[model samples]
Target chain A: MRTHHVTCDDDVKLLAALASNRDAGFEPLVGAYQRRVYGLALRLSASPQDAEEIAQDTFVRAYRALAGYGNDQIRALALRAWLYRIALNVFHNRVRVRRVPTSPLELDDGDGPAFRIEDGDPRTRPEQTLIASETERELAALIAALPPHLRVALVLRHVEGLGYAEIATLLDAPVGTVKAHVHRGAKLLRASLEAHNREEAKVEALL
Target chain B: MTTTNRTPRTPRTPRAPATPPDASLAEVRALLGRLRALADVDAPAALLSAVLGELGLDAADRYFSLRTPVGQIFVAFNDRGLSAVMRGESAADFERAAHALLGRAVHPATEPPARLVAALERSLRGEGKPVLRFDLRGLSEFEQAVLLKALEIPRGEVRPYAWIAREIGRPRAVRAVGTALAHNPIPIFIPCHRVVLSDGTLGRYSMGGDQIKRAILAAEGAAPDVLEELARAGIRYYGSDTTHIFCFPTCGHAHRISAAHIQHFASEAEARAAGYRPCNVCRPALGA
Candidate 1:
């Protein structure tokens, strides 16, 4: 495996090139941040295609705004926040155009297929794949059922592993409110997953 | 970094004859980790190229707003649109302003343009007459007052579903007010889209869903950004799998009620018979 290390100086160089209108500068920046930004968009949008579009838009918008950027400004603002903000705007626009009910499970564009975990892939050593698969499904469902705010908050907090203050800054809410959102959101996830497990067991018994 | 190198994976030992691979819990987590690795799948190359094609290098100062679903851009006017609609700006503040105007998630910078400002002014001045007025033509003594009251809602702003219920003196007739707004034929002139979910989401709009309503607002500079206008402002509680209720009342307090909380009365007389007074706050029937 190849190891890649990103120093702050590398970002500074990229920022300078991007500001100076050098197309090559975007390559390194895109490589370093695309996955993180795309992942954020997908979680927010709950659809891979929408996530991709939002991520692309985020970069385009970021590039356009790069000229006015300074090193101090870049250090102060997490690129993630700016990118996520752009992606969320794009997602909100989708929400409006499609008028998809605000529920996460209801994919507004029905053609965008649902993402499913592999159930029977043979590459894995078989020891406890079934148990893991079940758990994965449960986690996905729990995420889908959460209210939009709670789900986004939890994904940014735990899954992305951002600190509470960082999340509060990203969300533009008070730190206390951000903490509450994460705490309640996690509790709700645990309860929902537990309930789903119980219900699945009952259905299996019936079958 | 070598492009051909795959991410390192923990090597799995050959399975023991007696112990099947299915029995290994550690491997299950590893499988999940691999699936998670796929989470960063990039957008298709064609899509990326297309987006880049649209992005010109020197338009950094311009402001553009794209609609949801990712293909169409509604407004891409240069910085003039932003300045025409907002207060002041710093250099880097341009993107931030554009972002806010588009209503994505960022820190609250400025409240977008007030929804009702120009529309209310136009209505008060009686300019831009409705191309087609519905039953509101030759308004009755009582009806004229109600219609004028409904016009008070500015664009990108909202009043409660029940507020209109009380405004027309049909204090018990929230449903009747909805009917009146539903049939509001003059959208831009009457500005019926301003009425929203009591909790501030784009509720059921007579124009369409919240998006079209937002598009109209965006056109009017009523909201700075689409997300700011569309973001749900209040709490929603789901009573069951299929039933959800918005907890904020039209009157501003957070009140939880079920779908069945409001009885469906077939006619205005039937609603009156049920003794539910028109909510004094919203004046449901009054468009003003």
Candidate 2:
């Protein structure tokens, strides 16, 4: 999904009030963005519990650093990007805690509860349905198996739909490298799919 | 060489090195597609509430100067090994506050912490006011417009940033929208904390960063941890008597669902009249 700018004169005013200290200003900001942030948090963390913590942390961080946020440049950074960075950090730190290792299973399926195949907008056409169900499952498995950097790059580019430039800023990588990663990632996925299909056919023949 | 007409032939160029394996492309595509599918995933009420409460307390203490003092603090570490700190009040006070809040304390590195203290001092003095409000202040006209639309997102709700960007007539500015939010000013009220990375990651927050972000959502009445907390309290989505529904008013692209789509509706007519069924994904009616 694409992001649009929404700062208004009132936001500016509230921001001004916030510069010193203004709890009153916090509500409007909350009223404005609570859903967007929380929603994004849910998606990134893949766990309501984790997302909730990340969302609150994002705000507290923004509040504390309101002094150094540097006037709207953060605007150049999407709430998504900023929050993702925070979430990633949180996820990484959590990993350091020696929790039971998360399996390679994808959250939508293997890892967490598997989604009911019939779930989704049933009104969708058969063709779209087939593509969505089969291709999507196969693709997710392929992605889960990729290297972390490549996987993240693909997620940001295709899933997040971020621009190369924006991604460069977020990932701290050159645009050329980002492009290469995306292209290579796509190629690898295509190859894996072909290979998987072949294996499935071989197993079926034996059966 | 071309002028020699067929007399001089140039040697063929050697093929370039084989491209490296991306090994994850299909997975990435699937993951991306899954994000679109899960767009309707609702933010839990209990979780959001906790996060908002934490943020409310922090914001109240910081910008609002509410009854509380030193609401929150954010720390960052750069590649240069330089560390920065942004606290609500005095740098020293904020440091103490952090120690108190986190229940653990580490001595600040003399040089970096000192530099951070200096920056906070200048910020408190009002010299970097623009810098302080950069999240909203630095936005371009278009970005500002997009963010304004994003701000409309209600508590415990989410909409695609791309859709919002499209609503602003800048369909291609999806990334820009995320950027705008990253620099959001008056974060709690603007609720930039509510925004997420499109991949569904909670994304990053500059102030108090991630943990603080989580805390704020918890306070807002959203149930990010409803399941866990409920489990601890001996709760479950399937309760005794009444059937519950969790409706999400956001997601304009979503269809209007009625009772029939639900597994166990009150009655058949109630389900059909709505003309559409509730999604099984989030169970708008079930509150799952």
Candidate 3:
């Protein structure tokens, strides 16, 4: 999920076109929000394939909903918060049926992007890349394995940098409680990171 | 200090970055930053079209305006087949009406070209192969049956609402049959104008009233004056004196019957009493 800059004014333009003319500006809307929506799904689901499916479904549902809105109603929307809410619902609904448990292996593509960059760059230090990749992968896997409520809140808070207000709207929880849960989740994450680092020191002693 | 120090292995936290923006520890910030950066995957190049395909938007409902016997009209279709044909004041009006009816957007047709009009005109005149496929998707099963049966009326010929109702095996739905034909989305191509009142009068047409219906029928070689005359004379069925078969006045077999050999019956009972059976070709009603 590449960071996309779908400005509010741009969204208003797209919404105005879509509202006045059914389906107009839809492709561009998808273009603008696809990265953020896909990124949100990928983090929530921890699988690239499920992320793509969820992203596509989210946009499809958005299209159906936006078609019925008048210009002003559509223009007033905060697209990121709204789209993230839809993506969250799509992810949960899929999980309710598929019952896929989040395990460490699912985070293989969650953070470590070295496999793709290996062939693309020649100046890269393979040893340095390997160490960095291992660290990020371990951290991502830890985040992915968090309890659902904590994982979602923490990711929305720290990983995605969404404010508490938007996070509340997405998770449908009150702001104060969500902040506490995210802080508790962050503590658990730090403890896990420290424990994993201690294990690495023990392993290195043998080498 | 030297005796207490152990040889160092590879650094444990290779992910320490320039600065942790938040007050969170370096590893936590790095992990979240990487996740945020991965969002730049650009959503795979194929995803936009895949989303459109899922929303049923990739398959464009292509339409084009054309001039015909009835004047300018809109023809809309999709990969399924022709969905609508009607008159509109402008292309925008046509597009809006199509959206309201089909619940999807329509775009201008890029294919089908100028030759499409000629082929359809020939098909309507019974001179070309039956290449036109009517997309009657939104119609009910009964309405689809009614329209498809109406399609078999043979270009210049006419049938009654009751003929369609009976043909579709819903004899009591004669008025419903009229309603279906009246609301035929693809009018000229579906040829709803061919279905008239059982009394042989030109029925109301949703396209542009009876005058457009009469003109289109005239173009297809069904004479309006003859239909009017039959309506005035109260003739509901035409029979061949030699074949002893009765049909709707517009049936091809009845039209072929010579003036001297033609027989007109005011009612199906009269035709039955005269020993004439309903024509197998037109499949006229056996009961009242």
Q: In lDDT terms, which candidate is top?
A: 3
Listing every candidate in turn, what is its Cα RMSD in Å to the true structure after a full C-alpha superposition? Answer: 28.2, 27.7, 16.8
lDDT digits (tens) for residues B1-288 of candidate 2 = 010001124322222114345434465445446645533333344444455466544221221121212265444322222122343655566556544533334344334445544544453333443222222333479767865775566555444455466667777777887777665534554556665543233457756577665565565444445423433543222211122332233322232334353232232234434344543443333211
Docking class of 1: incorrect
Q: TM-score (0 to 1) of chain B, per candidate?
A: 0.32, 0.37, 0.79
Evaluated at residue B50, the lDDT of candidate 3 is: 92
- Give me the candidate number with maximum DockQ: 3
On the 0 to 100 scale, the lDDT of residue A146 in model 3 is 69
* lDDT value, residue B176 of candidate 3: 92
* Residue pairs with clashing backbones, model 3: A1-B39, A1-B40, A2-B39, A2-B40, A2-B41
* Lowest summed lDDT window (length 10), candidate 1 chain B: B1-10
lDDT of 3 by residue, B1-288 (tens): 001011135232222222224434555546556656544444666688799888776656789987776788898987667888879759899999998888777888776566667767677567966788777767899989998998888877888888888888898999999888888988888889888888889889889777899898898888988998989999989899899999887788888899999998999999999999998888886487
Candidate 3: tens digits of C-alpha lDDT, residues A1-102:
434577878878877766676665787788888877886776666656667899999998888888677778877877788888888888778767867564
Native contacts present in each candidate (fraction): 0.11, 0.20, 0.44
Question: Cα deviation in Å at residue B63, candidate 2?
Answer: 28
| True-vs-predicted CA distance for residue A65, candidate 1, Å | 2.7
CAPRI-style docking class of model 2 based on DockQ: incorrect
